[model samples]
Target: MGGSSDVSRRRFLQNAALSGAAAVSGVGIARRADAEGAGGGAGQAVDPRSTEASGRVMNPIVPDFAGEYGGKVPEFQVPKRPMGKTGLQVSILGMGGFHLGSAAGQKEVTEMVAKALDHGINFFDNAWEYHKGMSEEFVGTALKGKRDQAIVMTKVCTHGRKKDVAMQQLEESLKRLQTDHLDVWQVHEVIYYNDPDKIYAPDGVLEALTAAKQQGKVRFVGFTGHKNPLIHLDMLNRGFAFDTVQMPINAFDPSYRSFEREVLPVAVQKGMAVFSMKSMSGSGEPIVHGALTPTEALSYAMTVPGVSTTISGMDSMEVLDQNLMILANFKPLGEADMNALREHGKQFCDGRYELFKSSLKYDGDLGRQQHQFPTAEEVPA
Candidate 1:
């Protein structure tokens, strides 16, 4: 199993710690029990893509996460979408980098990447800081013979450092990813209050982005953050033309310090592709707490307006399979369903479930070190 699976379970445990509930995953993540009796009650394992042998629809979920999925869904490919004006096609399900690094080994990472590609998941998300370059290395090695089929995206973690630092990190990322150019290179984790000011400063990382594009080292440029929407707005309003922007997009976001409410429209208005992360409330907090089901959370993020794709953390083959099934059969939830989910998520709007915004749990150690803040261990949520 991937170590990220372990970490995810731990985070789920911690989140469920608040409610004393059991854990879930991309697979173990429990879905809603159909009011019309979809399957084995609320926690029944049903194939998400299509009907199973019992001629049952995959609507509900199984809380018994220890069991393997004994269901089968129809084979289908994930859909592609336009990535803003970059004119690049991106997958609705992008593979996350941190968990790619956390997989057991290169072989496991290769398997996951291959499965994703076979299903049309071309957008691979990564970072220069993930696993100290191990994530980039695994992705590089995995895409060795299939680089042309993937839209690889990685982030530079200057964390308010100079443009020189960003440029150096880009070089390292290219070397580690074994690529001549990055399809999308972004400014990683622009969460700090003064991050925008620092990035726009003379000789800042934005200069590195412009240089990378000018030098043919990267095809597109953007920024990402999971903290406040105000911070993302600050980045957007900085007068620089970004091709893409990423943020946390989930049901709870609408009720809390909502990036969906505050930033989604602005980016769409600016004609920028908006990539979503932390669809399951950064750690399946709501799922474990029995507020939102796994499918509901994933479906909601995938259907959020103006979102190009929902970037998910799939560390294991089981997780990958589950997410693929969800994507394969994905239909945009109706306006009423979407609004109902928003109302359902209102209870978690206090930042308890979304700890990435409210706490230090999802804060990277490298970012904290660069910012001179205490480690997550020192001051955890």
Candidate 2:
């Protein structure tokens, strides 16, 4: 466990970064990775902490996965960065909201949130639809007296509904999060093809975003989606101003239809706080399938230049401790190393690891119902 042996793991990562796995034709195992992790599916209440990491569907690219796999939790402070043009300094890492509901109970959520705050995490991501409002409730209870210490954000799931629906959801989100005002309020799951049109229509959710800010109910407003890059682009091109944008970012993203490649630069150019999610391929498929180590996946996502914070889900203390340990020994991957990792990810770039884009698997049932799309069971991917 000494830092002296860093070279072996680093070298192994280098090899994996440059590797293409088993070539594009050898994509069968990738499918199986999707299947094994697909049981609970996405947008569900699966505890992210329970993902088993040691034995995987495939052998690792290298056998030197010793040090990064498990390590002592460090008490050092996690780093912070500027939140785009918002002028607020937030932790480079954020605590995802959904997993809070999936945690064992209120005690676990309390511990995880407390630990996250102690480690300098100030940005918390949540949505109105997550865990049937349980996620927001847990985050609310955990942050009772310490509200001022965190930058709380939750999405209003209007989903093509009228402005009134957005407003109602906002009020409920406030009640569930136990806050009178939110640091950030976002339009959740702008995934459907006509989302932009619907949101920009007369008396749409965009108006709600404006009214929320004007009424001092929210400080900033933005939107989030993990679908096509074009959908995000469409949202950006529309007339309304957005304070932030959230999307999936990972090593595998650069090789495929990439939000980093297409939308990230635009959001950065617009001076929006860019929050990254799905750093571990939405459900740790790459790690569980031995495609990339957790360190490599997280490092790549956080290392992306324009990212304000990388939001990762931790349903148990173990996952949180692992993340803390990674941050303690953190170092950015160089541009060349990033490219190598992207090249390595080309093998699984077929959308197996990042199922949010590939299938309707990640879409929430509410969103599906709103969009008139199929259920999670119908399209399990």
| Local distance difference test scores for all models | 0.73, 0.75
Question: lDDT tens string, model 2, 1-381?
Answer: 213133224433323421232221122112111111112354232221233322332223223222343344657788899999999998989888876666788889989899899989898988988888998999999999999999998998888999999999999999999999999999998888899999999999999999999999999999998878999999999858999999999888887889999999999999999999888766666654556756677788889999999988766666676667667777777776676677677767689977888876677888787888777777655
| Pairs clashing within candidate 2 | none
Error of 1 at 113 (Å): 0.7
Q: What range of 10 consecutive residues in model 1 has the weakest lDDT sum?
A: 33-42
Question: Highest TM-score: which candidate?
Answer: 2
TM for every model, in the order presented, reads 0.83, 0.85
Candidate 2 Cα misplacement greater than 4 A, ranges: 1-40, 43-71, 379-381
Error at 277, model 2, angstroms: 0.6
Off by over 4 Å in 1: 1-69
lDDT of 1 by residue, 1-381 (tens): 223233233333222221211222333343221100000121223332221112221222212222223333246788888988889888877888876776679999999899888888998898988877898999999999999999999999998899999999999999999999999999998888988999999999999999999999999999998889999999999799999999988877888889999999999999999999878755454555544555667788888878998887766676676676566557878886777667656656789867778876677777787889877667745
Tell me how far the alpha carbon of residue 344 in candidate 1 is from the true structure, in angstroms, after superposition: 0.3
lDDT at position 48, candidate 2: 16
